[model samples]
Target: MQQAPRPRFGIMTAPMQVGYHDVLRVWREADAIREIEHAWLFDHLMPIGGDPGGPAYEGWTMLSALAAQTQRLRVGLLVTSNRFRPPAMLAKIAATVDVVSGGRLDFGIGAGSRPSHPLARREYEAHGLPFHDAAHAVGSLAEACTVIRRLWTETEPFDFDGKYVQLTGAFCNPKPVQRPYPPILIGGRSASVLRVAAEHADVWNIPGGDLDDVVSRSALLDRYCAEIGRDPASITRSIHLPVSYDQPGVTRDAIAEAIDAGFQHLVLGLAAPYPAGVARWVTDEFIAPSTWN
Candidate 1:
């Protein structure tokens, strides 16, 4: 019998529903599970789906805190919105976390947008950043990527006069512990954003959807990669899936479909406050016996 291909597995917390302690506990559980390889946090000022006035941990602060608490497991934002923080500061923070964690941060980024994803918009506007339209958002994000990459690897400060982001005498100290910097995972489904991911990202994350939906987007990404003379295989493929332990079959089907479609990583999007029993069951029962070996 031909064995199924098993991809890497990950978990992402409910950014809106959980407290700091609950989030840390989720990480602790993930650390204990050898089958789970990565853990992620949503980078938003407030809950993605809840009240804009609710409590939600900041992505970078939680990243640093998680790094300090856990011994294993890669950590990152489902993606830090380029609109929320400037590229240089995000780079500095990522580097610092990498240094503190002995290099275990995944630098996930995205061009922030969404009608329901108003939390990111609110964060930006509150901070005085005008919420840019999709095209403009991606334009600034594309430049932000260049800015971030150069700052991470460049030893000397240099001027970055990007149309949207401008900086002078900027340099990152305590360079990332991961050589060439931590894995960069760019997330989104837009043409402009996909192009940016192809040109620079080490991994490209497609938002969760049905098998056909994700596969189509991945194919488009491959096309984008090819147009630029880069092999599509050069970029790793991943998806953020909504996992409902109540329906084990749904979770199973999602994983199978994703693997069939060439995605090599899966991050379970758990409900807020860490459904501990359901999570542990999903990993140990459904996930472990899948033969990721």
Candidate 2:
């Protein structure tokens, strides 16, 4: 049997549920947890499926604040939308945050807004920005990802040739504090998005999927990695999903299944408001007996 990878926990919380004060408290609590390696927040202008008009803090802005406040945890968005910023600029933002955190930052990215989701369409309408089709958005994401990677590592500036964005003498500086650069995570389900992950991600997040589903998708990613002539093991496997932590056995089983499938980073969508001290609750009920620690 293969030795299981070391596990790292992350709380991928939707912080807008409560006020900003509670949001800060939740992060502090998460930071205090043992083995809690990352602190992630949803990168959305508003909630997707739920209330579209609810209060939501912008992802990158919240990240800058979190970086200064937390000492040990790596701060990042669960996945930032490519449409939000040009690739080079996004890289700069990430690098700056990494510096603020003293090298504690994980850069998670994804193709832009969803076309099918009603709220997404509404957001574009309200904000006066064009909501391009999914194909266009993914293409843009790929291009931006390329620019970000090149900017982070290169000392000299270079031109960016892309359909959506063009950069002459592109450069992002104070290169991320993490050597070689911060871990880049690409998250999504579509093939185009997966291909982008293969091309430029250090970590690929498999969000909202079942165990069997995760296996086949990971196999697909392996195929993508192979197609690119890149080793499949180069990318770290990660996931975040809603689970009924109320049923301790079920929660433990689900986590075990994910670990067996080679997911080293586990970010749970534990219901916000963290209901009765989530950290202590899980540490006692699941984390201890689950063999992750």
Candidate 3:
């Protein structure tokens, strides 16, 4: 069999003010698209870091803008919460975005966590929903996967019955541009999350943690995949690395170590001070170097 393509490198945009739209435009123009295989944004109502009053853009809307502006780069949320909307609706929205992006979409999913916005929390409370524990959250995620899969693959309307979500005759029109739906990426580091990724996800995106944590968790994920009778190679491993390289030549070593340990993608977080400056550093130091090659 032919060897699989080398894992691609990509960047995740920090949530910022709409005025920073021009920053994205500039990055794309500066050959960032050629350097990065994928460009991701977070799905959040407000900044997850720094000043709470800082401006942040809506993820899906930003993705839509990216789809319209870029031709070569894949675009999507780094991980969208399953609790934000019903699965059927989210699936349709994903399909629409995929079509708009000419089929370059990575559907990243995650369980809901503590809301960063008061309005979001209020909405959740108003719906009479309980704040989910990890187990409940994973179960809800499984249900979401079921609904999304059924909407994309089943010809007839389907019903989903789950503890957290229930759908009667949910249907999606104009099936996704990618056959059998776009790639599903699950984001987390817990054992339950690893099991879910082994069972459902095409990609596994783990957050940046201690180096030992990443290695041990990645090994656990491989074990889970084997136990589930799935090839470990089928699941792509990716990581989100923080952007805090105050010194030269550190980021490259980190990337090398991660790649050696079977990580295929690296999403650099630009949430620190001087995001635009960080963007330039990533493009010049990481992308322009031989790390990806």
Candidate 4:
């Protein structure tokens, strides 16, 4: 019997670094949206592995921009960190973005990690919070998810009391276009993260991990889902692959490997050095193929 067609193929926009603006332009011009299922950008306050003074675009703002510029590609934060913004506000912003894109928004989030910039520390310090503790981070992440779900699904003002956040009579207008809400994609490799994905996330993104890693982690996720009485198949499994277009058609092999490992989605992370080149390759090599059929 023929298997159901999998909704595969996604690309992750490198966060604003030294050359991201140029890359963004290339991607926009290439019109890669015609081929890819989704376009994602990382949510971070500062650039990773770059000069501290280098550029870094806000994830949500970039997503909104992509929503306006691209016609067919679904755009979202690869995963925004929950510690950076209140869940209620995040839900409103996601709803607004969803409405703007005519329902092409995928809401992905995670617990915030340490930033490189000293000023970036203000995000946690200003909140009178501590950094570098995984347990606290997971707790914040769980609470944030609860608040976001409540804000999206609850019609009346909702109240949430949690360890990290407390909300009273929180209401957001213009619910997301996706039935109950936009699909939620959560990221992290920890046990807490897996449990959260099983409980709430519609999709779980494994960043830069191998097939064996995914298989092991997936088992844990499935166990958590079973414990919660939720079907593991209900959650889409995705992986972030470091990809380079320099070798023509390199992604095809990677995609095949990912699919073999039961990954339903691929988040391709373009290689550096002329970042725009990756977008061009995707347009000419992937998008032009009429693969979706």
Worst 10 residues of 3 by lDDT: 270-279
Clash count in backbone of candidate 4: 0
Stretches off by above 4 angstroms in model 2 are 243-245
Better of 2 and 3 by TM-score: 2
* Cα displacement (Å) at residue 194, model 3: 1.0
Score each candidate by Cα lDDT: 0.83, 0.80, 0.76, 0.76
TM, every model: 0.93, 0.93, 0.87, 0.87
Q: Which stretches of candidate 4 lie over 4 Å from their true place?
A: 2-4, 18-23, 27-33, 114-132, 247-251, 272-277, 283-293
Clash number by candidate, in order: 0, 0, 0, 0
Worst lDDT window (10 residues) for model 2? Answer: 284-293
User: Residue-wise lDDT of candidate 4 within 190-237, one digit each (tens)?
Assistant: 888898889889999887556787789988999999999999989988
Task: Pick the winner on TM-score between candidates 1 and 2.
Answer: 1
Off by over 4 Å in 1: 1-6, 115-120, 277-279
Q: Note each model's CA RMSD in angstroms.
A: 2.2, 1.9, 3.3, 3.3
Weakest 10 consecutive residues, lDDT, candidate 4? 284-293
| Model 1: per-residue Cα lDDT over 103-153, one tens digit each | 999999998767456555677666676786787888988999899889999
